[model samples]
Target: MVDFQEFCKHLPFGLLIVNYKGEIIYKSQICENLLNNSDPNIKHIQDILPDSSIIKVIKEGKFDISPYKLKEEMYLIQIALEPGKLGGILFIPEGVIQDIINASPRVLELKHELESIMNLSGELVTISDSNGIILRVNNACEQIVGVKEHDLIGKSVYEMEKSGVITSSSTKYVLEKKQKVTMKQTTKSGRRLMVDGYPIFNNDGSLNKVINISKDVTEISILKKRLEETKNLLDYYQKELYVFQKSEQEIVYQSKAMEKLYDLACRIADVDATIFLHGETGVGKEVLARTIHNLSNRKDAPFIKVNCGAIPESIMESELFGYSKGTFTGGHKEGKKGLALAAHKGTLFLDEIGELPLNLQAKLLQLLQEKQFTPLGSTSPVQVDVRFITATNRNLEEMVREGSFREDLYYRLYVIPIAVPSLAERKEDIPFLINYFAEKYSHKYNHYKTFHPEVIQLFVDHKWKGNVRELQNTVERLILTVPSSQIEMHHLPDKLINTKTKVRGNMNLKQAMEQFEKQILIQTLETSATMREASKKLGVDASTITRKVKKYGINIAKLQFLL
Candidate 1:
């Protein structure tokens, strides 16, 4: 008396007939958007969502569904038990309507694209009606919210928050305005998301729906919050490393330009001269300044940083110089010690020096010339021993020529100019820097970190718009969420990875030598299982083999003799 086709007709979405185990025995209609180019298979629900949890519900004959945001593709799938048939419909979201447009099986771009999306990790996606009703939700959202996706749909936006107040008022505003909105939100799943709520407009210019794309930024937020703490920790570790590890001064530097920069920074570190650091953002000005300080006579003293760009012009002077009691509004009853005094025996780093107002510039020039500065409301000239390290991405030389900056102060600060080369200018340092940070943050974050050879080339090939900061961020990003034990070239960010997708295969003279070495080492190792044997076979000295092995981290002991 139970009709199988009649049972499927009761479901709202596309129905697929399945066996007793809920495998896709037969699909009544192919989910064109999801399986349009390929045949449907009986696999785990993660085939549609990278982090979906759908198998548990259908196997138990209970209702299960989850939203999946696979990169550029979005899907809302639902599955409920049927008595006669094993499976039910898989309701995909409306945007997947594009998957229905393929006329032939000549291409599989959509298939691969959806597959890629179904594999990416650490992402959240959702779709809602004009009323902000939950029409769809992804597994990431479920994991984040600690609830199943089916339970989420048909639940009004009102009953969900339960705080009785509509959270993310921006989402409401976006739906009303029918415009895209990007902002930060904390999900019910206890994670921070950089959410982008994009409103889908109907042809009539009315609000049809909104798609909320989100990225989990919990790790990034933690890293950003502990940025200053991480600095202290890194400084402590680096200093400790110097004590326990022997200093390889020559190894500390490999690039000639870097060596020249270090030489210039070291020469001016001991003296209390105003050293101007000129480099693109992320070229490691602060690190260089600290290194200079560490190598200087004032290694024992603190190196204070004044982020001029972050401070307002009105209070910039007050912050740079000390303030006496009752000198200005909100002044400490006990006079505050300015940075100049705070760094009495060490270095003071002024970042974004070009932004310092002209008035304050004059005062700074006076202090630099007079070798002392009186605190606000006090006449006594408080002189102290402090080294000045100023850095800027702007061309101070141009600013002076344009009359925006004081020439006298410019000349004073330019006394010991040290230009930090951008990562592109001296790309040989990219690999070294990547390895150092990978090792450093691997221990710091407790994450497994290793680099592939192609990954190194990708780093070297990047435009590095943010400079070393950009590269460091890219490295940190890889270490945090790259779901692999080893970092391959493909695991790098799309921007960096794409740059090398069509790289020229030509290697210059040095590259040829390296490849020759690689071939010799590979053949030697394959023929013999000992470095001694491989070296003896190749007619090279064993010490040379050892040096090359150390340089490349190759296991010489496993190598064999070659012809």
Candidate 2:
């Protein structure tokens, strides 16, 4: 009635149990600890100790106590048989069995060492039986799964998946395939785990156990995604930069003032000082900023432009200096990076710098002086390496005197000043500009057109109050309308025609009256939608409007669209 296997496990001497077929079924703790056997279960008794008579004694149902030598150590083997003919092999050393019991403390230490090995491992280790019942887990497993080791030890992996403790298990694959398997797993606590399941085989090549080594991969996955996104964004920026560079190669210039300005720009391009470009609104300040950036060593880096007056005052700070996560209502859950941070190791062009609000001017000054700025609602400042190029039509010095703009900020941004000439100052370049615009717009509108010599002279003589922008618009308008292959003097806007090209001309009264009549007819046609409208505006009938348009050779199709 007694359970002999349990009784033998408590004994000091080693004991092993084998079936009648010579297969090891059990091995006691003391036997494994003292013998230091990597595998406690040996299939045959002869394999444990060669030339053993223990199996013969079990077959004949006789008690045999004999001397046995194993690994050069003397031991006594006692063989017995159970009612069912199962074999029991007991090993006793040359000394008394009580001496082995006295060394029981050593066995306890060995057990503790095994536990320490598992507990100290950084990776999560989980052991399960061949039937997929969880038997044990290391300390790291508790932290990863958010469950106690004791709670998980007796449970089945299937039950855990059903109960939502873990999303899935890699042990199932090891059990089914009887080989090593690796898979991604997610726990109920939202930890991403990479689990490697290795199947431990018995001597008979059957599945004995499965050990899963898991590593938390949540942070690694997030970092990889961010890296991919950054790579893609960088590719996009590179393409845009290619386009910008190609267009910059097309800038045309012929005037002395423009030639001098370009030479100065090229000389200062490599310097790291702050550059301030001053010009009228229509003059090409932004173009000069691009020239400076392209000429510098940082040309390969980003060229970010922000219009201070265009961005609203409310979010300008956040737009300039990034904000932390959840810093404001409707903000991105993940923190946002600003243009300043995006422009690190590159150039940041702050156009219309004079229009920046007074309060934000101090922060701009901080970035200029300290090379850092704290984002809105953030305590820490982010440092940036940036070459600043600012452009504005406003007179910052006059504003500084009037207390409208900060004096300290003015000096900070005004380190190196370059003045761009207005369209009026470079009047000699008018003919060249006219031809350039004519070619540009003609190609854009899918046609060919040329300006008459008189028309070009008129443009050169006219006061371009709106500067280059006005001239560009005028040229595009003439190309788009003006139905003929040639844009003539009559195609000129009334404002340009009315302004005399020559101060003193050789025209007499007859020629002057005819020129005045032509100007009146062209101006009225431009302001009206139809001949009838022009006739009403000019205080004439439709027939007279029609006759004047033909007589003056005005492009009526151009007049209709202009209205």
Candidate number with greatest TM-score: 1
Candidate 1 residues 356-426, lDDT tens each?
98888887887778768988888887887778889999998899999999998999989878878887787
lDDT leader: 2
Please, what are the lDDT tens digits per residue for candidate 2 over residues 1-563?
A: 87977787778678878666556677787776655664744567667656656566667766666666664354666465672367777777767654665478987798688678877867789899988999888888778999998999988988998898888888888998888998998998999999999999989998999999999898899999999999767745653453344233545555568778877776677688999999999788887898778777799899999999999999898898889988988998887899999999999999999889999999999999999999877899999999999999999999999998999999999899999999878876676678888888888889799976557656776888878788889999989989999998777777776785353166655565566567657655554566677778668888987787678788867655343
Q: List the residue pairs that clash in candidate 2.
A: none
Estimate candidate 1's RMSD in Å: 31.6
Model 1 spans > 4 angstroms off: 1-252, 504-563
User: Measured by TM-score, how close is model 1 to the native structure?
Assistant: 0.47
